[model samples]
Target chain A: MSFTMTKHGNVVVVDVDGQLIVGNRQELKQKVLDELEKGERKFLIDFARTGYIDSSGLGVLVSLSKKIREQAGELRLADLNDDLKTLFELTKLDTLFQIADNRDRGLESF
Target chain B: MAPVRERWPSAAGSTGDPAGPDAVRLALQLEVPTDVRLIGRIVQLVSRQARELEFPAAICSLNVPVALSEALSNAMLRGNKEDPAKRVRIRVMVDPAGLVMEITDEGRGFDLETCTQDPTTPANVVREDGRGLFLMRRLTDRVERYTEAHGLARNVVRLTIKRPPPADGS
Candidate 1:
């Protein structure tokens, strides 16, 4: 997956592309966790190009969310297509997450 | 081996067809590592098909289509050797009662009963890899396996799902 980190003030807007599968899970997980450690907890994930994310990828999201919340900050996801949106909803994560409809909305929340 | 001819049983019966076939054949294909794209495609297919066929509200609530994608990920990522040429056949069949999804790989099958246990619950939730089966079992009804007419031993999985009540119980 290809990711672009554009900083809107403290909010790290991550634009991701390609299939977010098992192959690149660790890298993505580490990158997000590392940023969270650096005190950049505000995140807006754009799934515009992300084709798929398996359980591992979902784990990273859950783990990262937990970590960020522990730090008193938050990770908000935006632009989740129908497929990914259904996944989070099916898993009952829509209730747990601060999901934004678009980038403007996600960034505006911060 | 037999060139893979999948035919829908005219109607559900104990003798000719399966225990029952609320399961309608949605699509069939050889699953490859690259076929991960099909994951979303399959989920989308099931949603549209189920709605058009008027299967049941449970079909949507149980969300077997989503679980099917995760199962494919396990078989393609861990089960098979990840050879592009080593294809895994995916069959998604849905019945009014529920949906049955099967992914037949060209590799050896592993033990299901062992992996079904949630090792990480109170003991080791921190561990990885063992989580896939946990998620699958949690999402689908009953995940089981047996060889199709192809006689492909120990390399196939049959996940049977009982339709769930509507999320809001409507």
Candidate 2:
């Protein structure tokens, strides 16, 4: 999977393109962590092009959420399809995350 | 007997009742080292086979791939402890009814009852490690574990998902 980052006001919109599974989850974590280190706090991950995500991908998201929260920043997810939405619901992460219907909403929330 | 590492064509030419005379069944076995990189390739191969066999699009695209990736990761990381010498064995059986996959890892197995906790609970929502087994159980219809004792004891996670009956009338 690849990450395309764009700046909309203060929020950094990260577009994940392709499946985010075990193979490349760490890359995502590291990228977000690096961004956090650079003082980019408000973050939104756009899953419009993401096809699939496994447990590892979920784990990375959780860790990133926790890390971002610990830094007094925020993280949001947007554009999750039905299958992806179901995954978050089943894992109870939906309650933990501020998920938006689309990128604009996600950016606005931050 | 060594596990055959090959893909076998469908025993029955048509997708029908597995027990019926014209039942369709495809089998594949793979033995690979403890490498996380191979997980995607294996998931893709299985997902493609399921789609070609006419499994539901959701199952072929999302459910199977997610469940299989979790199982494979568990086998490689937790079961084998990432030992390069150890191998993970996969056996896949697909029929018109559904799919059954057995992931065998050459390591001491743990009790699934005690090992896995509800990741969705308030207490464990932020925990990163336990969700793999939970997702495996959630996405698939059946998630079972058994230890084979023929030569060496090996832990096998058997995942099964049955095809849902068609919607009412037309």
Candidate 3:
């Protein structure tokens, strides 16, 4: 997976593209960790272009959410396709993090 | 001559009678080394067939490939320890009732019950692992694990989707 980081007001937006799986999840995790090190907490991960995700991807996102929350930072995901949305719901992860329909809404929420 | 080896019931055969007219049977078997890149190829095969079978939007779009990839990853990573010398076998069978994906690996198997920790818990949510099993169980209809006579560990995941009745009107 690849991430392009931008700022929408105070929320940091990380747009991810490509398949998010075990082989590439670590790059996304590291990006989040680097942002955390920079003391930028609020995060919005835009998944509009991501075609697929696997268990490793979910685990990475969960870990990122917890780490940000522990630091009093917020993380919200946006633009998940129907398939990904269902996956989040099926895994009960929808209850764990804030999910929005679009980047503007996700940015506005934080 | 050595006794002919029969396919195991635990394999990805039809839960219902496969010969029935209503059953649209499609099967594919793949044997690959413990390489993560090969998973993309398997996903492509599964996703293409699932789409052709006209499975429901969700089943065709995500669940099948995701669950199958997880099973394959486990077979490659945990079951085979990413050993290039080892091989992982993946069998996918689709029938009218549902789809069955069986993955076998050449390695010493662990106790599935003991190894899988619930990732949904508050304390364990941030562990960044062990969620593969959770996702497989949640996404598929039924999952079975066994140690075959070949000293291989086989993980079978079955997903039930509603398919149209046979075109001939059986």
Candidate 4:
């Protein structure tokens, strides 16, 4: 239900705490869009603390990815649990985003 | 908000219980306004009930929450159009076989065949909206939609998830 932003080198890591679904998806979108407006382009969404994400959460991620790409920026995701990994795979979004094993790897990749 | 309504089946109807003849079927029903914020609480309630009924961890923790959230949000946003006067009715039945949930929304039904597009398709991957139905179908064992015409016409989404066979092949 919370999104915490931090900077590591050029990557702006957004850590998602708690489940991401319809109720709070708009907050996440606004936060990321605000960061995008500030010219912070390289983004990594860390999901280590995230319990789960419903379809609305996934939609926001897709929308954010598209927006970031339009601005010539990149977005990556890391630390998704097994269930979440399966979700991305099932939706075929695994191919659309660059996913890393952890935050460290995600930062390095950027 | 109106209080949740629950109904339990009588013991005499347990003749074909999946667990045993003595098993009692559990049911929970709720009617909430068309609000997205209530999705989490409802999901938690159903998830806890599934766990208490000895459903598998995967189904209790992930599948049920994700699929139920989708169904509820769909009912609130698309079915009911976020009408404040409208309400979403949820009924859950849990037995040893699995869980069955019915979500009824007070709205005219749409054609699921025409509305639900494959979100995985290359053209639709970035659409950001059409994946709810796809995820619900993929995560649950069954997803069915139908319209009820008694009084006000409404749409019902019935989802089912069955318990897997025991590991020892029992």
lDDT of 4 at B49: 94
- Please name the candidate that would achieve the greatest lDDT relative to the true structure: 4
lDDT of 1 by residue, B14-115 (tens): 246543435444544444453554555555566566667665653453345546667777767766666666676776665544566778776667777666
Q: Model 2 lDDT vs. the true structure?
A: 0.87
**lDDT, candidates in the order shown:** 0.66, 0.87, 0.78, 0.88
Per-residue lDDT of candidate 2, residues A1-110 (tens digit): 68888889988889999888888899899989999999999999999999889989998999999999999999999999988998999999999899999998887776
Q: What TM-scores result for chain A when each predicted structure is judged separately against the true chain A?
A: 0.91, 0.97, 0.96, 0.97
Estimate, for each residue in A10-62, the C-alpha lDDT of model 3 and write its tens digit.
88999888778877788899998999999998999999998788998888898
Candidate 1 predicts chain B with a TM-score of 0.68
What DockQ do you compute for every candidate structure? 0.22, 0.79, 0.55, 0.79
TM-score of 3: 0.81
Clashing pairs in 1: B22-B95, B23-B94, B23-B95, B24-B94, B31-B88, B120-B124
Positional deviation of B148 in candidate 1, in angstroms? 5.0
lDDT of 2 by residue, B1-170 (tens): 99774433232323544545466778889999999989988999999999988887888878999999999999999899999999999998887667888999998877888866889899889787678888888898888889988998999988888867666733
lDDT of 4 by residue, B64-135 (tens): 999999999989998899997999999998876778888999877777777668999999887888888888
lDDT of 4: 0.88
B1-170 per-residue lDDT for model 3 (tens digits): 99884442322343536545554668788888999878877887887887887776677668777888788888888888989898888777776556767788876666667757777777665566777877777777677776676433454334333454556888
Q: In candidate 1 chain A, where is summed lDDT lowest over 10 consecutive residues?
A: A87-96
Give the total clashing residue pairs for model 2.
0
